[model samples]
Target: MKIVTWNINGIRTFKSGIKKILDSFEADIICVQETKVTRDLLEESTAIVDGYNSYFSFSRGRSGYSGVATYCKDRATPFLAEEGLTGLLITHEEAVGCYGDQLEFSSEELLALDNEGRAVITQHHFTGADAPQTLSVINVYCPRADPDKPERKQYKLQFYKLLQSRAEAILRSGSHVIVLGDVNTSHRPIDHCDPEDVDNFEDNPARKWLDHFLSGALENGDTEDQFGNISQKSASGGKFVDSFRHFHPKRSDAFTCWSTMTGARQTNYGTRIDYIFSNRFLVENVFSGVDIMPEVEGSDHCPVWAQLSCTLLPSPKFPPLCTRHMPEFIGRQLKLSGFFVKVSEKQNILKGYKESLPGSQEAGEIRENMNPVVQGNNIIKKRPADKEAETKAHKAKKSKLTKTETKPQNNLLAFFKPKQTQLNPPSPELNPDPGSESSACLTNAILADDTHCNSTQTKSSDVALDTCVSVVTETKNQDKQDKETAPVEMCRKGPCSSFWKEVLRGPPQPPLCKSHNEPCVLRTVKKAGPNLGRQFFVCARPQGHASNPQARCNFFTWVDKGK
Candidate 1:
């Protein structure tokens, strides 16, 4: 699969440029950095391409700022850091409030902390290849424009440490991992077009950190020269051996980025800050790597691409899929209608029983029996109870159901228990408040799962590595329980099902101002510009209305309350 990495600067402004690159280059996986758009903004924005899954990790910036996004034609699965590693430190005041307490320190302190943009990794699964390949691709936009600042340099060092730890973990798992992005550093003097200017050359902190990482050295200049002087180092690494590097041995100078603001490519004034590095074992044969320096108008950075070929391996086998089954004891009780009817009528039935029957063997048995059933699929079967059994149950119960005959019968169970339906038809006047009781039952079911649910599928290999089945099963069970107990609204004499249904069917109108009790809307008036005649919403209420409109009421929602 062809994996490409590029720092698209601000994704919103450079989206068209990015689309052009993707359309022409045909990359299987693309790792992007400096997206500078929030998840909410991205959701509102439309992508120009199809057949690609995109993942974005955005910084908390109102306007354009530091951010990153990843796109892949293959199946892209988001892998968050175990302890919330996918976040950026606030550099300004507005960002401080956006993240709130999520940041460890104050805005000032965080500014003193790391200022490099966020780092995000997205794993892609490729099936067509011989082996089941899982590629961990990372995008990083390190700090820039503060070449003289010591604090900024320290931040870059810390960033490299964090990145190296993450990369090592992936490499240890025997997975093919690729780390790429704009490192904002030129490894050698040859990496820059003007190699003769030493006075203008500031120290390359990004290159220094990367060199330490690759050489496993603790300090700068700690390792001996493996590839001769800096000039020769650049020459050996710079060239396209053939059109693609793996095909030929001759070196050709290729640069990835150019200075657009100064028209510097004419004077050959550009630095090689962008790079792609793979695990040593994974780079058996490097086909080609090149920096595309086209005249892109919107962004300062250019897109980079790499192509490689490797020996295919057989797909690894995982353990057989285990089927989850509900416990038989609870399944029998759910089959009968009486259990549901009694529970629905007595809202505090479980609490009352627990209080009265404390330490009782029957109470313990009931708890044990319901535990697995609640955790598995949230479906509790009710066993049939005749008149004698009902009498016995009532004697054991701590609370009595008020107006027992006025309970709504279960329509779902009526099909199975046809005899019970014929013997005692449900009264037409029967009405049960399902909303409150159902919510209470759902809460209890979720709590029960929290206490008793355990992964049934166990792997003999590393337990930590094989948690996919367990994680998927837990999510599935939670979804099932949530669906079963979700509120069922009573629709009016209309084609739609509920209040939300009608609201979703059309565009929502602006809500009324809470303080003034009048219609309010946020308006964006355009100033003098060529982009004229654009309409925006404002408070429709006339000036000096009955009450102060208080701008736009944040608490107010635009929904028809009558529904």
Candidate 2:
């Protein structure tokens, strides 16, 4: 039985990645964190993926917030789904704390934990190879200690403490348990990118949380070591195993989660936070291997999987339709032009969602209905690949040239240069100019006369870059002159408010920072050409954003003129 845990960030955003993983791993159960799904979507059958029996816990406080879900194989039905930790009433009071204090779950006081859909435990009774066994599979997405929200840190600590208590109680009842998901806390310095950059040891709650949770038993009966630390063993005697760390014990520079920025993943600057933990019996008997799949695209955090050495039941014949949302990969690009295709598709999906909810949870495959936008005569595919391979290849070329060299070698006029080769220029038909027949004819004539476009050609740095920029510039001019138009007011009024600041922050925001250490912002600029004097967006990144590129985020987007 293979179980996988991934903070998919938003399940709908990378529904394709989920399908890809399900196809590959054939996991018996897949647990996801930060599902960010609301009750409306869940009840509407939009989020239901057909094959596995899925159970979702949604945030009760807000519409879309922290949510956790566990999908179990059809054959291995869950015995019970404990959404609210029974007998634990949790609420925020002024004196007690924001996350609430733990008192006896007695008759007078109720156990109402935060119903923000943070954790969900699905119990399954199965006939094991040895004997009949029942496993309480708990999937938790622990709260992060966000700097903006200090109280959340306290909430996280409380959640961690409650989780341990819950695990202890479950174990005391003689039931096997496997608690796994994003703990959202780096256990040690080795688990993070740079330990020195972190807050002081005395002030860091994460370190304190780990020490208290791992060192000594929280329960009364357990013995404390000489230093009064609880061994990393859970109250139920399942030594909390960081499966990845356990296997790659001394491994460094290995991370499961990376920053959303582009170079972060490429450079492999990341932290190991997501984990799979289980009791002694489950660990020793069922544990086979742990794999961190960094290659998987869709979420900022990669999926962490563990192989349980047991026979998995045959999967269902047809998988169900996963919920559709704006692709997260779309946010990875800084270009405004990059947003058009996805933004269009997202609007369509949102419109299509108005259909009446399905009467029953019948089995059916959901073929996402995403229509592509036609720009002039150019027809682009609706769905684009992550393009990670291309990015990696480019980086690899830079790496090869920079070998054993200092930072100065990164300059184009340095000791090394990219090997020049003959290449065919882009075809004239690449820009059909569907709106203007005259524009198309003129472009074709230019291509016919130009030697570069007339035949397969090799281009010098100046000629190539200039031609590329000209093509883009001309294309925008043609688009601006076309019937498809953008709101002039939107472009003229640059982002000012906090809302606009976040909205204008381009995807894959400039990796480096501006002169004042401020992150670069995407801003609009007016173009001067033979065509319409339309405004387009560009990365207002400073020179320092990238070591080489003048603009860190070479993003471009014409203002939307059309409704």
Best by lDDT: 2
Q: Quote model 2's TM-score.
A: 0.50
TM-score for each predicted model, relative to the true structure: 0.43, 0.50
lDDT of 1 by residue, 140-224 (tens): 7765646557776766665565566666666666556667777777655556655556643434556545555552221122223
Error of 2 at 40 (Å): 1.2
Give the RMSD in angstroms, all C-alphas superposed, for model 1: 29.6
Tens-place lDDT per residue, model 2, 324-382, is 22232113446787646666776664554333122111101112334455789996655
Error of 1 at 302 (Å): 1.5
Cα-based lDDT for every prediction: 0.48, 0.59
True lDDT of residue 158, candidate 2: 66
Locate the minimum summed-lDDT window of 10 residues in model 1.
317-326
After the best TM-score superposition of candidate 1, give how far the Cα of residue 556 lies from its true spot, in angstroms.
60
Q: What local lDDT does model 1 show for residue 89? A: 29
The deviation in Å at residue 231 for candidate 2 is 12
